[model samples]
Target: MVPVAALAAGAAIILSGCSAGQVSQTADQVAAINGNTAEAGSIALRNVHIVFPGSGTHTNTAGGQAALALSIINTGETVTDELTGVTTDLGTVKITPADGDKIEIAPSETIVVSTPSAGAETHTTGETVDTEAGTTEAAAIEITGLTQDITPGLTYNVSFNFKENGTVQVEVPVDAGIESPRHESELSKSTTGSAGGH
Candidate 1:
């Protein structure tokens, strides 16, 4: 069982950059509003957002790569967890972290998966990614062979596979709201990088 205090802290981290009725809402918010559970085993995923290209309002073209942003909090006190990969109906999520490894969270630690360095942004085009490139701490997932079946403001089924716990499935929201400060920071850096490149 997850500690109440730990869950509370996890909730706080998920809500750090969000408010009500906007993209600021975390994955927990989406899950709660959608009547789903964001916690699985000792892993709790929150504040998840998907990007469909062309800012927060436009949708990505078919075959275009999409991005994702979310936070994972390990509530276990003694066990560490590994996020092996992500999968969707479109196919397996192909993201080679600039750092070269799957995400591993220590007990009671939280890791946020966001934009990748140079290759892709959290959920935007290369132009969009250039506006938010600095930290490669987060993993950047590039969805290949994507078609027009997905769109923004809609929900999709995604599975996150862990080394020990197996797969946890959830519906992720394609949010364009810049409510998450960390999420926004990527944009800020992207803007800076874009300007500096000239």
Candidate 2:
């Protein structure tokens, strides 16, 4: 027994609620990252992850070597900083610079660090520096004598010691190498099929 105006208003409200697009619809459409990040003072470490040993191998055995990959950014406008060293309970981190023993980062500069020894097949973040462009410098951060297996889905705590920024501890993960949701779904289907056969 509602009035015509009331009924129309109700209908309008219902139509508005059922409209096409929504902010919540886009909520699930978010960006995904593979690595962890940490900030200390003016320095920010982005995409800190460990490269799995060799291509096709998903795990690195204990006591073996693993490469740590990350980009160190100096956010300060004027103050230059130096990466003094890196340490972790997992192993000893050797910082091999392209030129000298010192890893220097000028203000507003980014130093890309990775383990080149792991070879190009497995390296995820450690990219080669373009010497022709002569813009960014690259260094190698290798973790040797690992106490535990370095595998995907496991995170290890690593400390980055900067001369000016002190020390920042970051929990870094090993790369699983899954690039998209479809890839994950396909793998899941195959896994399900395998389980059903057993």
Candidate 3:
């Protein structure tokens, strides 16, 4: 039989070793972000996510439209980049800038992309912020002709192409709000009501 002291020492070693050689999942070690993030050259896409088509828990049907929201940040100190186009296998992306044909991101600047308002198509709104670094513009992004159903808790692949940064493919998820059980139940009721109305 093993001695009591040896057994106690072995248990202590095992317990201490459990935390060794493992990465910490605490907030200090990893950032708590709601959306996915990706990088393309000096440009970084933050909070990349797709908006659910409707308020209900029902999934967006195939060939329906959804909105993509993200912020494009140019980390370069001097080099400027232009977002030329965005594409996805699930659908075609339409980017509308408040001004200009392409969305421009000046050095050390950020451009925010948000979902279009209800009953509006290709909506873009932003204010010109003239800073010492450069001007920042806000744009709107919409994905149309989606070939697959878009539902909460699912991720879809989308590619963003920049004139200088090239392209970066990001797997984006649906909005985080609908992920909650309470929100899901609310959506179910609303979806049922809408279906009965129509």
Candidate 4:
């Protein structure tokens, strides 16, 4: 038997434990899953993953480029929000559609974007500012100037900016040889966004 006060406190701890990494995590888009599911406010981010450069289709410029693939779902029946900007600890972030013209997540609707060329890019001190792995959707954002290494299973933080919900950051997992089926495209085979949009 346990004291009522102690039991109550224990229960609180257990419940809060279930929400780990979610509290005060308004600045880490790199890790977005508690068993492959994460959320902020009324928006749930699912199957969130990041890809690094390797041989073949995944060959990015080492410390050059990376991309994020995930689905955004709005859980609220009447709530709506816009995905504005994206940022990573390794570099700068830019989103397509932008804030004023951002990708809107309607109530209970999931939006998927998979186009690396227009997605996110990680740049090194290369002559050009282009990413090797390019895929983006829902207003892709390119990350320029990478200051860290991108390797498989390596985790980093990316802050996702959203209208009406501010910024929600999560630690994203790096999958070396994995690319979302939807994100894989013929455009990825070519060196696109050399103009600096990669």
Candidate 5:
């Protein structure tokens, strides 16, 4: 006959191992929320406003260059909180005018950057009259390196530093908000409380 104590001890060891695995899994889930995982209620940018001289434009020798400025605001409560992990799809900044032509403004503040361009002026007769010296294709600036804990009802002012054709330096804004993730369990509790009060 087999000994009962030996079987009981073996069972206890198995249960202990299982419990440890469950705890590890829970920790991993929380870390995913902090950075890796794209769970529901993720962070996103909204209401972005880019302020620069003449609506942000860009031009190249091929006459296909376009200039564009960006003003982005965090929209999602959860995604905003994870700004540190946010990566911009735009590559880099190039061909800035001699005078530093890029600035980032806040909700109530503004900055200016300038670029100059000179092109020919055409007359109604399809003849080149005279080249008007003015700002041609504007420069395009994009923001990168966005990461922070975003809060609700707050705004941040970030700057994008352009390179000749390399990575840009995105300055972190001082007014950014950091918000905590909301737990669904709290809603359940509130519902239960309301039902009991009735």
Candidate 6:
């Protein structure tokens, strides 16, 4: 026959074991319930527009320096999670005519950000300068660091680096296929053109 104290201790051990099992079961159930409800969200950039400062022909002496403006509407619902970094891939930023010059773009909001174009000093004497004739430069604007959340129905503006001869600001339109140069090895050698801009 066991002593009364020993019986009490044994019963207590059994109760504790039961309690632990119940707690583990409850936790497993809660996790299973949440697993089904979890879903992934998305973000989209849309209605992008890049505009040149002036439609008039830029002088070759002004070093073909010009300004480019851009407007873009970022339309997408924010994720419950946070995005740390969002950036645009502006290919090799360089001034036209290979004058060894460069462009600089001052960062700003949705409004115009002034980026200088290449000047005439960058071009050779005999070269007939056109918008594309000048050296094309590329610079990426980092948008991810600006905010914690890029919420739905919000617009963010990013400016490219200035080109010495002239600035080519691209307006990335809605669903515009702005390919990533980092992935394309060939883009490193290809020249950037003014295909779509205002």
Clashes of each: 8, 0, 0, 27, 24, 32
From the highest TM-score down, the ranking of the candidates is: 3, 2, 1, 4, 5, 6
Candidate 3 residue 102 Cα shift, in angstroms, is 1.0
**Structure candidate 2, residue pairs in collision:** none
- Cα lDDT tens digits, model 1, 121-158, are 34332221121312224555656666655665687788
Select the stronger candidate by TM-score from 3 and 5: 3
Winner on TM-score between 1 and 6 is 1
lDDT of 1: 0.60
Estimate candidate 3's RMSD in Å.
Answer: 8.5
Candidate 6 lDDT, 1-198, residue by residue in tens:
579889999999888787575476665654221001111122222223322223333221222322222221112222122222223432212222212222222121111112223111122322332332222222222121122222212333433322222222333322111231345576446566837546
Better of 3 and 5 by lDDT: 3
- TM-score per candidate: 0.56, 0.70, 0.70, 0.54, 0.22, 0.18
How much is the lDDT of residue 15 in candidate 5?
A: 82
Stretches of candidate 3 exceeding 4 Å from the true structure: 1-22, 27-29, 54-59, 116-124, 128-136, 178-198
Worst 10 residues of 2 by lDDT: 119-128
lDDT of 3 by residue, 1-198 (tens): 569989999999888776556543442464555479999999999988886555522235687777777888999987988999988887777888857777888889888787555222233576655666556566888877879888778898888999998999999988755335554565475553464753
TM-score of candidate 4 versus the correct structure, residues matched by position: 0.54
lDDT of 5 by residue, 1-198 (tens): 378988988999988787476575665553211111111122222223222112223222122232223222222222112112112333223433212443212222111222222111111111122223211222233332223322324333432332211122232221111233555775465553464753
Cα distance off (Å), candidate 1, residue 85: 1.7
- Candidate 3, lDDT over the whole model: 0.75
Name the regions of candidate 1 deviating beyond 4 angstroms: 1-37, 52-59, 116-136, 177-198
lDDT tens readout by residue for model 2, 77-150: 88889999999998878888745678888787778776544542332333445433233577778877878887
Q: What is the lDDT of residue 193 in candidate 6?
A: 83
Query: Model 5's lDDT to the true fold?
Result: 0.28
- The C-alpha lDDT values of all candidates are 0.60, 0.74, 0.75, 0.58, 0.28, 0.27
